[model samples]
Target: MRIRLARPEDSAALLRIYAQYIHSPVTFEYALPTEPEFAARIGRISETYPYLVCEENGGISGYAYAHRQAEREAYQWNAELSVYLDAAAASRGRGTRLYRMLLDILPLQGVRSAYALVTLPNAASERLHASLGFRTMGVQSEAGFKAGAWHDVAWFVKDIAPHDAAPRPLLPVSRLDADVLRRILDTRG
Candidate 1:
């Protein structure tokens, strides 16, 4: 399996894999995309956020991405991460390969830390992040509701790099910045 930057052509497969997370067992309530919206988002997101996917035998098997953890400029240095692996791809090492690639590359692009909010009691998801160096950021029981069920959300975080002790002003050089990523994606077309 190979982990690489996601391409425009790979969006369909990426969407399919993410949609799997909304099904039973996971029971996530987010609505899956309609065909038209799916195409538009793939074209939109793959450019800026450093979205990535894992492929084996020429088919995408897993995907991940990073986005602003908060909207304010003061929160610029931190980002949230999302990783979803196709069930068929899990336990076969695909998720690990893909996430490692993302973690390694994103920090250099200006990401200081990446946070993940997983539904509570999700050992598999929690363990995956822990093994990757993420520490628990605690859990909020019944923080969200989906499909008429209350779900606990666990927050896990990992710092990508060691920053200087000085509290520096947010700048492009301090980290590539999400805005920079936004610009990069715009250039992909």
Candidate 2:
């Protein structure tokens, strides 16, 4: 598997993987975004945070990204995390590999806390988050209505790095040094 920064051109392949969850109660999304819309989102988020993909034999197998947790300035150091994998790629340790690189890269961009929300009853997702040190904060009971039923969301949080009194200005992913970024991708532990 190859892990690298996501590009706008990956929108289509990424969308295909994401579509797997759209119809299920695992995700609240009821409709798939248009290709252009997904492309725009990829371009916008990678500007300041890590948006990465794992490719197997030239095909996108899975992807993970961090987006603003909230609009308030105080939440700048915190981000919401999400990941999706191709059906064939599930349970093969690819998600772990993608997340390891993602979590490693975030600290360099000044991320202090990372959050994830898993729709209730997803044992695999919850297990993955737990393996990565994410602690359950709480659960939103029936927080969203989807697929003819209300679903709950379990929130988990992980500290990416030390939260100091004063944080250095966030470094955009584009400005990250190539060698440093390479080391992150090559990290196995």
Candidate 3:
């Protein structure tokens, strides 16, 4: 598997992987967005953060990204993390590879803390986050309704870098040198 930055062209494959989670309690989304909407989402996120996809044999198998944790400027140093892997790609360590690359890149963008909100009973996801040094902060019971029932969400957090009283503005992924960005994804933990 190879990890690289996400492209708008990968939206269809990315949506396919994400739509599956919407049906299960793994995600809170009720309906899948249209292809154009999804493409716009990819474009919007890549503007200021790291949105990555893992390709295996030339097909997108997994993806991960970090977005603003809150809209307020006070939250600039914090971001929410998300990851999805195709069913066929699960159990092959693709999620780890994608997530590690995302985590590795966010700090370079001035992110001090990264958070994940995982739907309850998702042992696999919880384990993956925990294995990467995230600590369970708390669980929000019945935070969302999905699949005709209420589902809880577990919040986990990891500090990627030191927090300072004044943090520099986040650096867009596009600002990073091509060779440096390539090395970041290609080098393994």
lDDT of each: 0.69, 0.89, 0.88
Question: Candidate 2: misplaced stretches above 4 Å?
Answer: none
Q: What residue pairs clash in candidate 2, if any at all?
A: none
**Top-lDDT candidate index:** 2
Candidate structures ordered by lDDT, highest first: 2, 3, 1
Model 3, TM vs. native: 0.96
83-160 per-residue lDDT for model 1 (tens digits): 788888788766666567666656655567888888877778888898999999898888887867788888899988
User: What is candidate 2's lDDT per residue for 1-189, written digit by digit as tens?
Assistant: 778889999999999999998899877878999999999999999998888899888899999998988998888888888889999999999888878887888888898999999999899999999999999999999999998888899999999999899897767778888899988886742
Model 3, residue pairs in steric clash: none
* Candidate 3 C-alpha lDDT tens digits along 39-86: 999999999898998888878888999899999988888889999999
User: lDDT, candidate 3, residue 84?
Assistant: 92
Clashes of 2: 0
Candidate 1 segments whose C-alpha is farther than 4 A from its true place = 24-29, 165-189
| Candidate 1 TM-score to native | 0.79
- After superposition on all C-alphas, the RMSD of every candidate to the true structure, in Å, is 5.7, 1.3, 1.2
